[model samples]
Target chain A: MTGSILEIRDLRVAFTGAAKPVRAVDGVDLALVPGEVVALLGESGSGKSVTLRSILRLHPENKTRIEGSIVAAGIDVMALSGAALADFRGKTVSMIFQEPMLALDPVYTLGAQITEAIRKHESGVSADAARKRALGLFERVRIPSPERRLDSYPHELSGGMRQRAMIALALACNPKVLLADEPTTALDATVQVQILLLLRELQRELDLAMIFVTHDIGVGVEVADRIAVMYAGRIVEIGAVRDVIRAPRHPYTIGLLSTRAQGGRLSGKRLPTITGSPPDLASLPPGCAFAPRCSSATSACLEAAPAAVELGHGHAVRCIHTAAVA
Target chain B: MIFYASKRILFTLPIMLGVTIVCFALVHLAPGDPLVSVLPPDASQVIKEQMMALYGFDRPYHEQFLRWLWRALQGDIGTSIRTGRPVSTEISKAVGNTLMLAALATAIGFLLGTLFGFVAGYFRDTWVDKAASALSVFGVSVPHYWLGMVLVIIFAATLGWLPPTGAGPGGSEDWKWNWVHVQYLILPAVTMSVIPMGIIARTVRALVAEILSQEFVVGLRAKGLSELGVFGHVVKNAAPTALAVMGIQLGYLLGGSILIETVFAWPGTGLLLNDAIFQRDLPLLQGTILVLAMFFVVLNLVVDVMQTILDPRIQRA
Candidate 1:
C-alpha cells in the first residue's frame, strides 16, 4: 500500500446565520500521496476553495466553524493548538493565493518578505543564511537577477515577477504539501503558462504533494494527476485525470466537459447546455444538489442523495446511474 | 527624489506669500489706527500723524508692502511697538517656548497613541478596541481649551500638585534640569495633546487593521509566523501613515495652542499673538503671523518628504 502524505475525511464547515449554519464545505474527503498532484475543480460557489482554507484553519475567527479530521504528515491538524499549529503550518504546508498582486505586502521588498517566511519556520537562523536560501529559491523559480530583484518592492516588479516571488516565498520553508488556490487565475495567458509550468517543475523537483484548486478544467489538464469535480458542496466525481476527462460518469461532469468544448460558437454546432445553477445551501433540496441541472437525473436522484460507487480501480462516482452511464 | 521635495517646497512658497499679503492687508484694514492702540485716546492728531509716518504706515499699501518685504528679506522684522524690542527677538523667544511645549506634547501623544492603537487594532472588536475607540472619540470631540482648564482645575488649582500657568523652570532664556519643571509640564502637555493623541490612535488603529487583513498577512501566517511576526510587519508597514498623520496633527497643534496657551498663561507664540492683537501692535502682529505661516509650511514640507521616503509607491508616483 502506498503511504498518503495528506488525508481529509468528512470535513464540514459552516457559517452560523440567524439560526442555522450555512454549509460551506460538507462531507469532503480526499487523499494525496507524496509527489502527486490533485486538481480540485469547481465553480465559484462549489466550496472547493473553502476546503483548502479549512486545512490551514485560516478562516476568520468566529465566522466559521470547522469540524473534520485533517491529518497532514502524521499530525492531526484539527487538534493542534497555538504555537504547535503555527509550527505545523510553516514547515508542513505552504499555500499560494490567487491574486499575486495582493499576495505580497506593498511596503516590504520581495527579499525581506521571503526572508521573513524563512525565519518564521526556522529559528536561530541568521539573516544572511535566510537571504541566501531566498535567492536560491528565486533562481529555482526562474526570477532574473535574484540579487538585484531582491530589493525591489512588489509594485516595482511585473505581474509575472510578483507571481514568481510569491512562489519563492511559498517554497522558502520547503513545506511537505503545497496548496495552491487558483494560483494562475489572475495572470495573463503567457504569464499563466509560465507560473503553472514552474509550479509543476518545482513540485517534481521537491517531491511535494500538491492540491491545485481551480474552476478552469484547462488548467487541471496541464498538471493534475487526479481530478475531483465538485458540485455545490459535494464531490460528484473523483478519479484518475485521464479516466475522468476521457469518459466522465457523473452527468454534471459530462455537462461541464461538453459545454466548455462548445468553444464560444453559439450557432456552429448544437452545443450542450446545463440548465439552472448550484443550489443555495440554506434552502437546499433533500436529494442530490445537481439534480435540478442534470439532464439524465431521475426521480431517485431527486428523492435521495446518491452514494459513492467504485466504478473500477480508484475511480468513484457519486451517482446511482454510474453503471448505466458507463 | 530631491526634485520632488524641492518641487513641493516651491509650490508652498506662493501659498506662504499669499498668506502674508492677505494677513498684512487685513490687519491694516481693521478699525482704528495702531497709534490709537499705543497712545492715549486724547493724544494730539499731530503726534498720531508723526507716529504713523515714522512707521511707514502713512505710505500707500503697495509701497508699504514693498518696504516691509525688502526689510523682511534682510531678516529685519522691525520692532514691536508694545515691547520696544525687535519683532524678531520677541518672535524667537515665543517660538522657542511654543516649540518646546508642542514638541513635548506631540512626542508624548504620538508615542502613547501609537502604542494604544497597535493594541486596539490587534485585538479588534474586543474590549481593548472598544475602550481605545471611546477614548479617541472623547479626545476628538472635547475642546482642547476646556480640557486644559479641567486638567488645571484637577491637577493644578484644586490639587495644588503643579503650577496652573508658566512654562519650564530656570527662566525661558535658558534650559534647566529640574524634575519639578518636567512634572509641571505634564498637565498642560497632556491637555494640549488629548485631541492629537486621539486622532493618532484612531488613525493607527485603522491602518494597522487594514494591513493586518491584507493577503500578504495571510501568507505570513501560512508561513508559520506567530501572531507576533504578523503584527510586527503590520506595524512596521503601517507606521509611515501613522507618522504622516502625526505630522499633520503637529501643525494643527501649533494652530490650536492659541486658546490653551492663553488660558494657561503659557506665554507661547499663541499668547504673544493674542497680546499683539489686543494691543493692536501692527508690526508684532504682522511679524508673528508671517513666522507662524512659515513654520507651518516648513513642517508640512518635512512631512511630505518623510512620507515620500517611507512609502516607495508614493515616491514612484
Candidate 2:
C-alpha cells in the first residue's frame, strides 16, 4: 500500500430505508497507487457505482450506513466532517459522473462551476485567477474555443463537450485521485473512444489514481491498467487488465468476457449471455452470489460466499473453483 | 438574454389582442342591459333613441367595438354612466390600489411558501414536511373571503386592534406608504395571501423535490460545496418555475379579488367591478375588465422573460 493515493479496506455500504437494509457494497477492498487506472468492471447493480460513490461519501447520510476505512492522500475519508470533508472533495479526490447532461448544473455556466470549485477549495485564490485556471483546464481538456464554451450553459454544449467540461470541473482543484462513474457510457460510440483517450492522457499527465467504473470490457481495455470484476456487491476478481481478460478465473468474469463477439469465429453467431440475473441485494441467498447463474457451481460454492484466493503477480480470485472457468 | 426577452415580449402582443377581444365579447354577452340603470322605464322611443345615440349604442356591434377600441387607444375609456367621472381615471385609481395590495400579498406568500417548501422538500419524509404540507393545504382549501371575515372578527371586530374595512381613515381609498395606510392593507392582504401561499408552497415543494433529486444537485455537493451552497443551487433551479406560479397567482389575486374586496370594502377593481355591474355602468365595467386582462398579459410576459434569464434551458425553448 506504499505510495497508494487511495485505499478502501473492507468497505461496506448499505441503504437503510427499506424493510431490510440493502447491502449495496459489501466487503470491498481496493487500493489505487499513484498513476494507476483501475476499471471496476460490472453490470448494473453490481456495486461498482456504489463503491465509487462511497469514496466521496456521496450517498445521502440519513439513508446510507458506511463502515470500514477509506483513506485518500493520507486523509481518513470516513472520519472527516464538515469543512474538512468538503475541502477533501474536489481537492484530495474528485469525481466525474456518467451522464454529463445530468451532472452539470443547467443554470450555471461551465466557467462559473469550475471557478466555484477552484475558489471553494482555496479561499485565498482570487476570482480572476480561479477563472483563468478554469479556462486553462477547459483548454487542457481540448474543448473547442475554451473561452466561449466557458460561458455556455450545459444545454448549450454537445454531450462530448459537456463531458469534457465535466472532466475540467473535476480536475479544477488538482485532486490526487479521480473517481469516474461510467464517464463515457452516456456518450456516442465515436466520442466514447476519444474521451477514453483524453482521460487516459490526463491520468498519465496528472499521475491521478483513477477508479474508472464501466460495464463495457472494450472501454476497460482502452484506459484501465487493472480490472476489478464486481458481482452483486463484491469484487470477485482483481488483476492486471490483460491478465483478468485473458485468464479470467471467476465464472462471472468468464461469462462476461464470453458475451463479447471477440472476432471472426463469433461473427454471425448469437452472442452468449450469462444466465439468470444478479442476486437481489436485499435478500441475497447464503452462497456465492454468482452460483445461481454459474455453470461451474458445486454444492461447496453454495455453502458460502468464497474468499479471495491470491495468485501470483497480484491477481486475486474469489472462487471455490477458480480452475473451473480457466 | 436581451434578444430572448425581446422575443418573448413580441409573442405576448398577439395574446394581449386576444385578451381584449375576449374581454369585450364576454362583457357584451352578459344578461343585463348596459343602458337600463340610466334610462327611465317608460321613456318614449324618440328619447330612448337619442340617449342610445349619445352613448354610441345605436351603432352596430362591430362599429361600436371599433369606436371603443379607438377611444380606448386614445386613453379615453369614456365616462362612467353612474359616477359621471371618466372611466380611465376611476380604473387607474382602482388598478393602483389592487396592484399595491396584490404585490404585497404575493411577496408575503412567495417568501413564506418558498421557506416552507424548502423545509418540506429537504426533509421529505419527516415531521417538518408534514407540518408545512398541512399548513399549505389549509391555505389552499380555506375559502379566502371566509378567512377574511374570520380575521376581521378576531383582529378587527373583537380585539379592535385594527380597522375592519376601508383603504384609509374616513373610508378614503388613497394608498400611501405610511403605517396608517399599511394597517388598512393588512386584513385584505393576509386573507388574499393564503391562496398563493398554499399554491406556491405546494408548487415549490414539488419543484424543490424534483430539483434536489436531479443529479446536478449531487454534482454540486460532490464539487465540495457545503449544504448551504447546494441549497443555493437548488433555489436557483427552483426559482423559474416558482416565479411563473407566483406571477399567475398575482394575476388571479388582482382580478379575482372581488369577493375579498367586497368583504373588506377595499376599493380595488373587485369592488369597482361589483359597483359597475350593479349600476349597469358599461364604460366602467369595460375599462376595469380591460385593464385587469392587460395586467395578466403583461405579468405573463414579464414571467416568461424572467424565466428565460433564470433558466438557460428556457431561453432555447
Per-residue CA lDDT of model 1 for A1-326, tens digit only, reads 24999999989888774377778787898999999999999889899998998888887757788887999999999998789988988689889989877878888889998888788778898999999999998899999999999999999999888889988988888899999999999899999999999999999999999999999999998989999999878898999999999999999998889778645666677766787878887666778889888777789988878888888868999998888887
DockQ of 1: 0.68
**Model 1: residues >4 Å from true position, as ranges?**
A17-20, A261-272, A324-326, B1-4, B29-32, B43-45, B168-175
Instruction: For candidate 2, list the clashing residue pairs, or say none.
Output: none
Per-residue accuracy of model 1 over B1-317 as CA lDDT, tens digit each: 99898888899989888877886787888887777777888989898898889998899999999899889979998899987999999998888778877888899889888988988988898998999988888988998889888888888878898888776665455655477566656777888888788999999999888888788788777778888777777877887899888888888766538898887777678988998988888899999888888778888889889988878888778
> What is candidate 1's CA lDDT for residue B198?
90
Question: What is the lDDT of every predicted structure here?
Answer: 0.86, 0.91
Interface DockQ per candidate: 0.68, 0.87
lDDT for each residue of candidate 2 in B1-317, tens digit (9 for 90 to 100): 98887887888888887877877788789886678888889878898888899999888888988888888889898899998999989988887888888999999999999899989998897999999999999999999899999999999999999889999984655457888888999999999999899999999999999999999988988999998899889989999999999999999988958999999998889999999888888889888999888888888888888888898898787
